[model samples]
Target: VFFFLYIYIYILRTIMANLHELPGAQADSVPSAAKTLVWGPGLEANIVLPARFFYIQAVDSSGRNLTASPGEKTFEVKIVSPVEEFTRIWIQVLDRQDGSFLVRYRMYATYTDLYIHILLKNKHVANSPFILNGPVYHEGCDCPQSSGSVWETHMHCPQSFPQIDRDLALYASVDPERNAQEIPQRFGQRQSLCHYTVKSNKVYVKTFGEHVGFRIFMDSILLSLTRKVQLPDMEFFVNLGDWPLEKRKPTEKIHPIFSWCGSNNTRDIVMPTYDLTESVLETMGRVSLDMMSVQANTGPPWPEKNATAFWRGRDSRQERLELVKLSRAHPNMIDAAFTNFFFFKHDESLYGPLVKHVSFFDFFKYKYQINIDGTVAAYRLPYLLAGDSVVLKQDSSYYEHFYNELRPWEHYIPIRADLGDLLEKIQWARDHDEEVKKIALTGQQFARNHLMGDRVFCYYYKLFQEYAKRQVTEPNIREGMELVEQPSDDLFPCSCHRTRVGDTK
Candidate 1:
């Protein structure tokens, strides 16, 4: 038995070494025509694509000696997406070392380039008027987003088919602060930082992924604004801050919007700590607007652009400013990518005894652009698949909606989310109040497990730590690893990451 064990160990090492020896053989499961990688950087970066084999060939652009590993290592590249030009990357052959003839790309981190294709001819929209490209409009927005929407986005005139106009201006804004002085938000109305009406009938906002804390931060600010305003409006305010729930054993500050209702503490959170009051709302509103303007270079009499995006350290905190017109450009596309957003839509349920609002949340990776495709078919800088309950678009508007201002994670969750009286309809529960509690609990648990950072961080940390420690010399390891010191820069005192190779699998 001992002799066999030794032979098996030797064979495993030999296979690993020989795998690198065969240059033409691609690793198992990497793709040939590289699609977007889920584990790269930014929003979709957190997702993992299936392993495939492909070829890696790099050219030195900066005249710096190319650094790479013979086997597997993560490498960074300035992916010129529009032109498909990758500069300053070291190349290697990714082939099957399994002794099989079939070879593809695998191992290490490679750039996942996402492209948007808009084949719209000017004649279509010019000839006919349509409010938004078509979701069976007038039929009702049944998607997850529409489920949470407060007002209508468009109205269909029976006389004019296909012609749709915004039912009400759910979003509004005032420039220079003076315009806001005159316009009074209707009594019992909440406004976005941009001054847009926070409620829309055609839109049902479910989650602002990555905009606020993945664990539930920034939510209280939005709901608190209605309180700080004038008399009638203030009386209808919703208190998002929950104090009683934070007193649990672990003592976690629960965000307003959580993806998990299945968890206990994540159930319907009520109570206003009053810590995040109206002033905080105003501060958040102003700060977010500033971030947006700066990101887009929206100084008057100048073209708006992307922010000066650069990581404090490991080259990840990207801040760019560009115009929206160019955001959805195809293949080698360039959009004013200031921040990233994730959107979703779901059906509305009237089981109100406890579940007040069906919830969603963002994962803080504020770097991407959103191009609304359909109710569920938009293009993002990175990539994400469609999910049930919500059709989310990833873009600057989406990003700022929930993540602008403080950190990439600051956001608005359940505070004033328009539930449309969904909670007031729980009729058949064994216990009236208990049924409502069950519903709210369902949503909270989902956020805790799927959207919350502590939830994600714990799982990812455990898995990554194990893998990173297991790796001897692989580069571009994600944030946490025992062997690596956090990557840092003098600019942002808080921004840091682990310096490991980029993943290609």
Candidate 2:
């Protein structure tokens, strides 16, 4: 037995030595085309319930194992909807031994296309999209038995739909058409903008995949209309977001409308929707409302909180790095750090010593909160506004759905993008304590009065009601296409328990 074990161990060591000598073994030797991305087992088009670990490996063109190269040249993964690039999640890569990396995403939400972008020195070496589908299984249902029914199913889970916040009904306004020449009128009226007809007459919304933002907008609109909107009854297909025509191979012929565009500059010609994060209605699940209550309950009032302006988030862009630099210079007056520094290249001496993360409640401990632009407009703006701390916002071109309504100085102080005047702004806020407190109260009032969940639904209902009329003809919600429901698990499957990689949610 000992002799046999010795021989087996010897063979394994020999294999490892030979693998290191392969052409693709070293970073310098491997040609750009020679590198390949591969998925681990059970990562099929229709994924099973109780998701398994999603793994992706970096290999040589010849299929030999190779460790993932980090730093300047590395792998970046995201799962985004083709039509509405608005819905996206950045997937974090976990390094394994040899040349493979595990994609640490729990398959809780159903998404299509694994968007992979491999860059070397900021140049794209390879970009590919692979399909990743969700299942039709119920929480208590045996998923394996009905696994084959995933593609044929649509909208079985009612809980996945966004519910109407009846308390916010007061925010609903008169139809947009009624006030085409002026701002619409608002009153406390429980009116259904659109009504559901007989099942055959109902319009079916076919989502290419699950996008939280898109889903919220669509679901709210549908729920307001009682799910009456549907595809047109005529021949052909329509497109929403950027559903690729070449890649779409539906089982049936249908009309597709090019509706709902976001994220990228490619604006939708019909129903233009901005980032939903601006409203508390759509992002209730992503942002903690409990934090707001906690802030109001236990934290000190504006005058008693920490005087330093605080900010913490991923190092997604150069602006965030600049914020960190300022914090380092005035560590006592300002607090900042990279929520996760592993993804970006940074000077350790400059950022490492000060790197740290704070809890959501921590914002209430400080009298001022810093807001800056991330990949898009900062998603944390609404959350920050709820903290009752004076907000020091940087100038940004990116706007959310309701950004136009927020006035600088009245609600929050606006700083230059270069952060040249952050210190001056901070000093001014401290000197004018009464004025700062008023601004903080105004920002908090805006969030409480206008950005609540139901108000968000009202926006969707109005937008869709107007958009629905613009269709060449009244859209008929007849049944004939495939659609999928969003997942409603309290916690989305994630690689890390505390944080989701590259995502605010």
- List candidate 2 stretches off by more than 4 Å: 1-287, 290-298, 346-349, 353-356, 474-480, 484-505
lDDT by residue (tens digit), candidate 2, 1-505: 9999999999998987787466545542343433555544224443222222244445554655453333212555555555444543424454432244445333334343444344433444343444444332212121222121231132121121121222112223323222221111111022111111112213344333233234455444333232212221221122222321212223332122223322222221222233332222222234344222332332465557999998888877787888888887899779888767654555645566544577776767889899997765676777678666888998875545556679999888999988899999999988999999899889877875555433443444444333343344333343433333333344433222222222353
Residues 193-288 of candidate 1: C-alpha lDDT, one tens digit per residue: 111112211101122112323212223322222111111100011222221112223233221221111123322222211221222222223222
Could you say which candidate leads in TM-score? 2
Q: Candidate 2 at residue 235, lDDT?
A: 17
TM-score, cand. 2 vs. native: 0.46
TM-score of each model, paired residue for residue: 0.18, 0.46
- The residue-level lDDT of candidate 2 at 181 comes to 17
